[model samples]
Target chain A: MSFFSKIFHPSSYAPSAPSLPYSYDQQGQTYSTTSYPGNYSHQQQQQSYYGQGTSGGGGGYSYGHSGFPPGTSPDVIRSFEMVDRDRSGFIDENELQQALSSGYQRFHIKTVRLLMFLFKNPHDSRRLGPKEFAALWSCLGQWRGIYERYDRDRSGKIDLLELRDALYGIGLATPSSVLQVLISKYDDGSGRKIELNFDSFVECGVILKGLTEKFKEKDKGYTGTASFDYDEFMSMVIPFLVSYD
Target chain B: MSFFSKIFHPSSYAPSAPSLPYSYDQQGQTYSTTSYPGNYSHQQQQQSYYGQGTSGGGGGYSYGHSGFPPGTSPDVIRSFEMVDRDRSGFIDENELQQALSSGYQRFHIKTVRLLMFLFKNPHDSRRLGPKEFAALWSCLGQWRGIYERYDRDRSGKIDLLELRDALYGIGLATPSSVLQVLISKYDDGSGRKIELNFDSFVECGVILKGLTEKFKEKDKGYTGTASFDYDEFMSMVIPFLVSYD
Candidate 1:
């Protein structure tokens, strides 16, 4: 299974990484984990996040966690070193962007923008570092928050009843009319449950990715930069699509 | 009350709107009142989301789920009309640059490059518009979210306890230890909670205005056009700063 597959199927790969087996010394600074998050079975996701490129210094996301063995693998260490710029053991927006930008001449500038927005703080100048980066990737890699609403019963699939209740929990009670429309669109032949499998995931990703690319081009046009910037990348893109259909 | 203040106290002002009653149905779109959740007390908070500014023809976020009289002083609208060359209800980054250049000439080139990073998207050709501009403002205006981890109860205030929690939330538990080092040396004992009040709002607006100026300058620096081309903006600026603590 690729890492993308693993992220959506935590149950299938939970055994690969139990609790991220790393520890901290009072500070929130964490060490390296003994295992992978199983969901990241594929390496492309790492490439996307770390900013590594096959040819030279384009950029990509780093994969190494803090305090982990240095010789995990060239690809892994390369990922770590890129994000661990300044070797401070933390990968902030700066480091992450540096890591994620490798091997590509053009990226969706909006992605970088979103990243900068997510990590920015008016009161502090500190950027996200290694530990924070790791935690974020761990969460995103598995699409944890994207669930929107979850079926806690672990029934292996989420149905309308389960999804509706989850939305209600978040203070959003969809009118029955809207629900019917969504069901007719998403549900296939049978009306039992609506499961968002890999196809749906890929479809959603493609659509969002398209929107993201649009923002990147505009960002490039305004800034006059040929390459995509990490900070303003997504901020300029997400707003148009933040609403549900 | 100033525009920023009205966001917090909507009822204090008289409703003089003359257009169709305050329904979300403008521009052939049906918007839900629920979409404008929270009261005017929080509108100012939305304005500051992701560091929105008022330098050019960008959108402004107004709270209060009611109506504003028709001829209720087109000051805000003036800000938009100041640019919007075609008055098509949308202002691209280039239009924004033109609006700001007329005011602040020394906004510089690097600043525009940085600003572009803040708005780029990789998926589509869309740039910032009024509705998006308002939404972005709202998302970042709630300054509490920026520092809320430090303020536990969400009472919209930050105390010492809250500050300590913030330190812990970021992985540093020893508040006394780190605070003694960073804060004691740099704290200055101002007793300020870094509130997002009116004064700060103005300062933020000025900063965004500065961004507009910078964007115009960058465009001029490139082909002397009103807007910067994608390549010119990026190549001219190196190692752009994402944040300065």
Candidate 2:
């Protein structure tokens, strides 16, 4: 089975990684896992991460975990590396918030945390790594492009109608009820007609991606239908809902 | 409470969503939720979606869900919106795989599905909307940037040494032994040194993010340094590591 397939099959899953195997020997800064947990079957097969993100590289600097992520701009990567002043390869939620603020745009801490939560890497889910950071930048770039293109009136942000166009532009085509839900979520409670700023736009976009991605897995045959037992459903979702940062 | 915080504390969470409330009706094809689900307390304040992702405008502009994801692009959102074809304000795994592939690249179906298992939206958990899509994309973007930067040799991939550098470069400074486990998981068994392509990189990055994120929630201040009573740990992680997916 593919590594990912192994992830959802919880019967074979071991949430607790058998006590880390190795600990930092206070005397020697070195770590070792003398005995692996099922050789860390799923963890190794699917657990190691490379989160090390940059919610626009928010904080001073932090540490990094180990793992690989994929394709994005060198600048985004450079932004992450440069911020790794401690040479720790990772950026915390703050650092990530900082990174996005400096490198991309200033995103709210809530947004940044959500960003960290969604696009987190395999190894470092808490922080930002090069790979996930890069992906985030790219995704942002894509979202930005859409926003600009769809903000028909040049209002800087789009309205419910315009938002629909934008969503339709990229093919999302949400329903009016669903659209209202989206608009309300990013409404900002300003009580104005729902005009989405770039940040709001991104939040909307990633949530769509994250949730949709999760949904598709269960909707076998792409019939837009699937069923889950109670626990199964929770396992399918809890991650996005679960809070760490 | 922050929307994210509202997600994990399940008593407040209603997973089923009251049966979609409004259906296509098959007549005019218009959808309306006469009564929102608790005004979608968590869904709106927390529920509601905006998935519609790209997984790379997957499979013919499927449809769109609704919810506002933040910090991403409209395309990413559009990608998310487009993917939700169901307009249920969510995208199932099949849709997500399509979205990722359509919006980003052709992700291994398993990879996208597994990611859904790891990252979920409290609303549907089974699918995505704009809110979660942006979150996933944000993390995905970060992953991309890291992958590019860490693949220093321009070989389009990384070896154990490079992986370590990449992880360290970001902040996820994992132990060498642990890295070994990560490498072993993605190896192609070509009898050559272990190497990871972008897909493996994202997989590793996300897994790392998912596991760490989950562990962090339970571990609190320090990770790998916290102890859990068997039940608590299981309850905390069983949702993600369960066979439900």
TM for every model, in the order presented, reads 0.29, 0.37
Cand 1, B chain, TM:
0.27
Q: Tens digit of lDDT per residue, candidate 2, span B19-133?
A: 1111212122222211211211122211222222223222123234345534344445555556667776676777766545523346565466545544566555456556555
Query: DockQ numbers for every candidate?
Result: 0.04, 0.02
Residue B216 in candidate 1 has what lDDT? 30
Tens-digit lDDT string for candidate 1 (A1-245): 33223223344211111111122112223322111112211211211222212211322343354543322223334455555668875555445544444343222233433433333332332454433344334423333333432546665344556544533332223334333333333444353556543223222222233232332344423232233222232222222211110
Candidate 1, residue B238: CA error in Å?
34
Q: What is the TM-score of chain B alone in each candidate?
A: 0.27, 0.61
Q: Model 2: residues >4 Å from true position, as ranges?
A: A1-73, A82-87, A102-105, A242-245, B1-245
Backbone clashes, each candidate: 90, 176
Query: Could you tell me the TM-score of chain A in candidate 1?
Result: 0.29
For residues B51-83, could you state the per-residue lDDT of candidate 1 as single tens digits? 332222323344321232222223334444455
- Return the top candidate by lDDT: 2
B230 in model 2: Cα distance from truth in Å? 37
Quality of candidate 1's docking, in CAPRI categories? incorrect
Top DockQ prediction, candidate number: 1
